[model samples]
Target chain A: MNIIVCIKQVPNTTQVRINPETNTLIREGVESVINPFDTYAIEEGVRIKDKTGGKVTVVTMGPPQAEDALREAISLGCDEAILVSDRKFAGSDTWATSYTLSQTIRKIKDYDIIICGKQASDGDTAQVGPGISAHLDIPQVTYVRKIEEISAGHAKVERLTEEGYEIIESKLPLVITVVKEINEPRMPSLKGKMRAKNAQVLKWNADDIECNVNDIGLNGSPTRVIKIFTPPPRKGGEILKGDTHEVVAKAADLLKNVIIG
Target chain B: MVDYLLTEEQKMIKELCHKIALEKIKPVAAEYDEKEEFPWPIVKILADSDVCGVYIPEQYGGMGAGIMGMAIATEELSWGCGGIALAFAATGLGTFPILLFGNDEQKKKYLPVIASGKKLAAFALTEAEAGSDAGSIKTTAKKDGDYYILNGTKQWITNGGEADIYSVVAITDKTKGARGATAFIVEKGTKGLEFGKKEKKLGIRASATREVIFTDCRVHKDNILSREGMGFIVAMKTFDSSRPGVAAQAVGIAQRALDEATAYAHQRKQFGQAISSFQGIQFMLADMATQVESARALVYSAARMIDAGSKDIAKVSAMCKLLASDTAMKVTTDAVQIFGGYGYMREYPVEKLMRDAKITQIYEGTNQIQRSVIAMNLIKELAKNK
Candidate 1:
């Protein structure tokens, strides 16, 4: 079986800042890292490969500098990596990003499984995985919390929900979008690091992946960012004070006023 | 002496240590290097994380980590910033002599705060006249009623200027040579003890080093380590246990070198193909890989021998230090070569790695002294074991 984990390189959130005047994020000086959430998808792919005999390949779409993220995934035990990077692909929104990723997945053509983080920290759309599934016309397993089983041609999965989890079986060539709670990521080992250092990063672009000009990248993006802005500041909560009995009576009085009013 | 292989919890330590090194150490390394400054922030990081006294006994409020666990954490942390790790290593190197041989009072008075990172410590042994030849130390600690007046200069002391506690070595008897050397724990800012300016180093800039001077510095008679005359043996014995740690640091350095070189080779191009695909570069890569593995085997072997009750540790420890340091120098040098012109520039990561690699050879008993240690210890072991 072949598993492809779609990872994203997001501007490291720790260094990010919001412009006070313009209410936009400051992207400069922000380093890129594998979306903290994507790490679990790569880890799950490796775990599944470890259990069954197969290969784990990672694919990402971004600028040339994004290669670092791919190499990191390789270090985490992904057997192969590809950079779906190109100048023409710049400014792609979630719709275009998923379309590009789907094209690259199609180029691979031989994969039995595709996995991705449920959402990118920068985008938080949680739409790309399902979008790719829709683009590829394959049944998808979203928010997968566990892999129940995998056999000759099918995958048994347990997807998480608000109340509990549900087990579902999907046919071959399926897409799985994982949540952060699914499994803990593995530490990169000496051997895994060595492999990551030497692994080939096949760079594909819109043209190489055979994506139609109007169907991907900025042109294909149905949702333009227009202008990114920060959310408004939160207001302070009410203050309560005094000893236990007095505080409780005062709180009861406040609650009565809030509800009665 | 117990098994040193990592348990599940240790893997967590390893991951956390790596994260700290990359996140905290790398950014400031250049600033500290340029100014010859102490990275107080790194100390705060280590202290807040409560990882400083890795070897301190739990009863004394330490993690009480074994030698191997300490070695692993030290190795990973050293990779990101060797100087910072050196500053923290001073905690163990300076106090292990105390923890290993200190009386119950010493343990109760010192171990807890040192391990907790509340009080930084320094180990003073290399004197102006005595480095590898530690017996020739000229520092004198004359007995004075209830105290000992220490008069000596300790060379290249880690945390010399910033530490709260210092474990110093001085001569108590001239005629006895190595046997005359005595060890004492002198708290910093003592009336007679003063530190000189920091040393300008090629790398590990985030951690500071300096010369500590003692002008009639006085400590209570109880500050002596093991015994008055055994200071030389105790300091040397400390190295026997600590040399593997330096070797572990080299492993971290070499690992980073391999990482940078491998990443560069694949991305960098020559002729019509990726440089990594070319046979000539492949040979170099092969050599780099082999050197790292050899150094690792020697290092882990010495670490295991230390855990296995083998007196053979001194020789093996020296061998590991020599091999690993040498490998770090070579691998990092080649890593620069792999980067070609970019390796020479400061902006590139490999250049910093190259600079970082040089000191491993000079510090922790220069590779030359490591050879002497191995040769002498080997002769002694073979004569008995053979």
Candidate 2:
């Protein structure tokens, strides 16, 4: 079993602060951390590899600093890591991002499973995982709470739903977007940290993955954010004072007057 | 650019320790302090997390992040609970003698068990007669055939009864004075070895402190660390290497106090405005934050020097410990002042932090001892120049 996990680097929410004057994020002192949801995905991929006896590879798409996320994944028992980074990939929307990731997977050419977090916390857009599956033409499961079982040719999982969960069985070569309920991510062991320190991360740019320049970055993105603003603060409501009967009478009178007006 | 930034690995270690401290240790800290319990649950978490193994070498199944890593972890954990932090930090204190002086066989036999967190280790040098003067400890190890008989007692030994391995200093030759003392690896279950009274302490109650009594305790001759009569050397070397960890603990305590005071000052109100608006309170907070940052800088620099394999680190290590612990004491007291009446109550965190801050000044050689060590080294350096 060869498992590949996709992870993302996001600003630590605890430390993020907004600049009031510019209405933009104050990123100067903010620290970057692996997306909390992606931790579970990495853990699930590593767990599958541990049980089935194969390698776990972690991949991420961002700037050069995103290598930290991949190395962190490697520290948690991933056998290999890849950084898919290029200036061309900047500002790519969910579709373009998924396409780029699928192209990288196609280049790797041998993977039994692809795991990802249901959503990136910063974007809250849960489309990338399913989008990757759509691009790869592989079976995909979203909101997986648990991996019930995985055998030679099939995988069983508990897919979360509004009403409890549903046990879904899918064939091999599947993509899974895991929820936080999947597994607790383990800390890097002493040996694991040393291994991560020495492990070489394979870096792939747009040209390296044979990505089309026309379908990447802001030019390829279909959606654009024209404005971002905080909602207005809520005003206090009027209180109907006095006894219940009197309050009801006054409220009724006000409602009738407003309706008539 | 003279950058004082932590390495990527050090940052990760700090983050891990901070998480564990907040999630695992903080909730239970007050309870343990109130009950004066030994904090076994926290010990279990530290062991399982490989926090206990931070200072050990890689071959022994440890992160081998050295003093800098240990200091970073110590600071973060101490921020949550100084008493609980001591439980983990003391293990490094115990294990350093072995790492610095233990021969191949000893390292192989002892380090793996400790690095795996299978057992705890302790350093016992202080006795009834010896406090700052460690050279006068009365414990004796008399060689007889294949074993050396150890007799006497160790007082105020941290992790005393709970530890499985002990690095004890004892007199091997009465005529040789301090040079006569030797360090030995005495297993906990050895016949005639027993734990004496457990001391009730004012602060850091979660950490265990007790007397270790050895009544004609038998020890294998092979357990001697380095060689005979190297006991003082081992003890001093271990302290030199570990003082930065203690300093880090102080920095953590001070930082915690500063954070609590700042948060409280902003929300607390007087004269229709937050007390934080007052210039008096602002100055106090400014002082607290400055001292905490200064201590952190000194502690990190000393730890980095040790990690860089600097031989002449005694002066800086002692200065770090002295300044940081003093800073902790002052900052915590001022935090209580900032909190006013509420800070006096145990329901709030500042009072607990204040209590915890007092011990950093007293332990790992008192702040007075640290100052002397620093001054003596300074005088010696001046003499060399003359």
Candidate 3:
């Protein structure tokens, strides 16, 4: 079996402070780390690989610096790392981004599974995983709480749900987005780190993957970011204080006002 | 809490330490703990990385790292793998005695290999009867011609069975008690030098421990640290400096506990809402988080003091060690409670965390002794108040 994990590099949320000047998410001078949620994705891919002899490869799409995140994945014992980077891909929406990834995956000779975090910390759109699955036309499972089993032809999983959990099974070459409930990612071993220090990452772009240049990157993207701003700050809820009867009367008046509004 | 005030070089050291811990120490932490296996792989990995006689001057082939830098790195590595980090830092503990007191020949001979990570070192002082009261050591080094014949067992020795060289303290004169204690360097394979069975410990079990038995063990007279009657001070001074590292260990442990608890509270539900949403459980987590931050502050303050070259290392280190370890015990216990029955089970990480946190109070001169040191030092400060 061959498993591929999708990871992203996001600004360290713990250290991220807003920049008042541009109101844009600050990337410059802000330390970047692999998205914490994505760590479980890589761990899941590696786990499946460990259970059934297979190769686990981690892939990320971003600027050149995103390679650091891939190196981190490698350090965590991933067998291979790939950087799907292209200048033209910048500013692409999740749809085009996932489409390009699908094009890239079509080029890879063999892979039985693809996995990723439920959402990127910065975007939190949660569209990429399903978007990729739609493009690839493979079964997709989201919010996997646990991996029930992995076989030669199919894999089983327990996906989280609002009610409880749902057991799902999918054919080989399926896509999965996992939550942190899967498992705590293992720390890198000394030997694995030595391997990561010298490991050669496979870098690919539109030309390398043989995708149409026009339909990839910014040119291929269909969405445009006209403006990005924080939502208005929330005000405190109104306080109703008085005797019980008086408070009830006030609450009734407030409800009437809200209904009219 | 306090600033790592990490200089550029110190920052570089932190990065390297982070890499070693995350890449090397993290994975093996559980395996070594589970098997109680000696962590030579991790020690060698560190020896090959940024560790190994880290505090020695650069002229001696060291990184010229400072105590604060070592403290930061040690805590991080311990956070990743406490047992392995302790094993690696044991080299610094053993060789510091030599660096502080050894002659030029000894410095040239020991520091380079140690700095280069070829040799591992251990410090021997604790005996079965003399732990907290280290001054009452009974291990004797009898002088015979040009050699000193050591005859006694050093108990609870770290890296004892595996160390390449040991900085040992023994009574050269039985009449002087604390004043009679003299320090010496005993190399592995020295005649009459031997090891006993490995100890079964609750925590840091992966770090090898054994009784270093010296039955007529012999070494050259030049191996003595500082001078006769100064061994007690040397040991005390070493503890004073090393206490911050132990406190940092506690800080790391507490930080991990809080992180685990916070993450779990958000996921593990009780009744209708997530446990985190409940006021009762939320307050517990809130207090745990606050304690972790406060403990970190105290530990860091002491580290900054030593980094700033404060005249008295005793009072600050004692305060940090005492507060941090006690906080770790409380936070870890609370973390387990928050985890509920899962916390007590082996399947949950909190149980392991609870087990690991218990030792921070026991080792490094138990928190009780740390309080005594704190009071004694504070009284000294009061006596000199102006």
lDDT of 2 at B241: 95
Which residues of candidate 3, in runs, are more than 4 Å off?
Answer: A1-261, B1-5
Question: After superposition, which runs of candidate 1 have C-alpha atoms over 4 Å from their true positions?
Answer: A1-261, B1-5
Candidate 2 chain A minimal-lDDT segment of 10 residues: A186-195
- Per-candidate RMSD vs. true structure? 18.3, 5.1, 13.1
Name the lDDT of candidate 2. 0.89
Tens-digit lDDT string for candidate 1 (B1-386):
13346665455457667877887776776676667677787777777555675667679876656566567778888878677787777667887788777899998999889877888887898987887787888889999998999887889898888888888888999988777888898998778999988887778776778999999988998888788898877788788888788888888888888888888999988798899998888898889988988887778778767766677578888898899989999999999998899989977877777777788888769999999888887788789988
**For model 3, what is the error of residue B274's alpha carbon versus the real structure, in angstroms, after optimal superposition?**
1.5
TM-score of chain B of each: 0.94, 0.97, 0.94
TM per candidate comes to 0.61, 0.83, 0.63
Between prediction 1 and prediction 3, the one with superior TM-score is 3
* Model 1 residue pairs with clashes: none
User: Of models 2 and 3, which has the larger lDDT?
Assistant: 2
Given candidate 3, what's the lDDT at residue B88? Answer: 65
Best by lDDT: 2
> What lDDT does candidate 2 reach at residue B61?
76
Candidate 2 positional error at B51, Å? 5.0
Highest-TM-score candidate = 2
Arranged by lDDT with the best first, the candidates are 2, 1, 3
